[model samples]
Target: MSQPNPSTTPFKAEQTFLAYNQTQAKAYVHGRPDYDRKLYDAVLQYHTSTNGQTDTVVDLGCGPGNVARALAPHFTHALGLDPSPGMVESARAQGGVSATSEPIRYELSTAEDFGCHLSPPVADHSVDLIVAANAAHWFDMDRFWATAARVLKPGGSVIVWTTGELRCHPDMPNCAAIQTALDHMQNTELMPYFNPGNILVRTRYAGLVLPWQLETPVPEFDQKTFVHRNWDVGEGFDNELPEVDLDRYETIMDTASMVTRWREAHPEKVGTEEDYVRRCRRTIERLLNEAGVEKGQEKIKGVMQGAMLILKRV
Candidate 1:
């Protein structure tokens, strides 16, 4: 398939192809919620539980290589694949990695485009584990499953998870307003690419079965689904480390939209783009205040809650 121009706005097809690039990849590494230690434990346990030959692990959509960093120690080799150069860079920086190692390696490539780009990429039926952190939504699941099947060793497992709506404390008045906007965004066409649940189930319409027809189907693999909540009201309780400002936040949101940032990058529209960014910041400020976010605690809006579903390849 011909790749879309990176300079252009993102449509549905374009969105799928370029969802994880430098811009979103950068924010994704820093802005996404943390996966609980238990999540990592579950991953390790799944691999260990299956006394087969589990060695190499591939983290599809491994933004910033966060998941790879967590699993690197356990696996003989860990591969973090992504489409965004910026994200791959961030992953290399954060994942305590320099180049490819036994437990960790970062690649600037997409899961869908993995084999094509890799000169001698993973061989057929050679990989023991495959994972997609919060990024599987961007993949064509049928193609992804087929690709995974070709690479996974017999009895190898694939684990993919997506978080659910967050439940935060009511003290942060701004939380409610921000949440409302988030919910609204979800309902609108704006967030179709962001919702993992919708993306996964809907892939069936594309003639993709849920891993059932694989040569080694895992119909009854370990499944854990639940509402996960979180509360962190104290000061300095930031999610993305080092703490970025509202300006950075604005750039990320706009870049994610691609439509919104086209003007920003064009010199002729600088004035208009600046105004739009200001308005967005103001709107966020208003929503945060409505949610009980105080003047000094503008960052409190960063706190969040989420749910996770783990699908282990049996």
Candidate 2:
């Protein structure tokens, strides 16, 4: 049977992520940013020093195995788990990119139901670190935390992170007009289609309800071990590097989950899955041309605010 929709409220047992398919997976692989290497280094260092183990990592909601592959070198084994089979397939196809001795294995499983379906189930207190990159908002947090409590080794860590909305700054004439157009399109067209999970991301996950913080506190979890931080330096923080290329930025916009859903909902309206994307692209190019940004010379500096939540098992 097909998994239930994860979009619904109060998350039933049947709930599943159905929005992502092979096409979306391909777009995701191409458009998603490679998470900063510095973040991974710091997380690994902290995990090894605090937990005394760096042997295994389980990447939950691992779309295309990006995080798992990036981190495999530091661990003896890495597993990338996701609810979508198409995503898992894409991840496997993209394998062999890691320079590590360990290979990242991709599996079709949700964060809540992961260990239950494995042949040799993940043992209690076995996983050294658990991570969810740009995909934690969809989780049924209560169930996920319960699973984390069961699988995490003593002092093992859980690191969840997501990149937030983009803020554009173009170093061209009429910069204010360009920024205004971009903001209008994002706020008016794109924001309407975003799913409820986006609320968690917008709030930087600070408003998320953690199981350990529930009335009674989740057993086996250390309430005192939780930490959350917003790591994004904002738009003007990095000036040395060249700004985001407009073409690449457009491709990234196509990967938004809401855009995918909107495309599905309006198949007859356009040729592709993203009608708004076409419109936005056209609007951007038109505004750039009006502002005298020569063809193939348009660039805009932008930064996505990123947030992280770190926790440990007692």
229, model 1: CA deviation in Å?
Answer: 14
lDDT of 2 by residue, 1-314 (tens): 12222333465332224456777688778887777667787678767877547778889988788788878877777888988877888889887432356567888888988657887877888898999987788887777888888888888888888776766544555667767887787677667666557656766776666766655457786667677877766332122243667677767777777766676678875554346777766666777778788887766666567788888888
For every candidate, C-alpha RMSD to the true structure in Å: 7.5, 4.9
196-295, model 1: which lDDT tens digit per residue?
Answer: 3333322311222345544555444433421122222332222443334566555544534333334434546444634544555566677776656675
Poorest 10 consecutive residues of model 1 by lDDT? 1-10
Model 2 residue 261 lDDT score: 65
For candidate 2, the lDDT comes to: 0.72
For residue 289, give model 2's deviation from the true position in Å: 3.1
**Residue pairs with backbone atoms closer than 3 Å in model 2 (clashes):** 4-16
Error of 1 at 135 (Å): 1.5
Our model 2 lands, by Cα RMSD against the true structure, at: 4.9
Model 2 misplaced regions, further than 4 Å: 1-9, 12-19, 96-102, 170-175, 234-242, 271-274
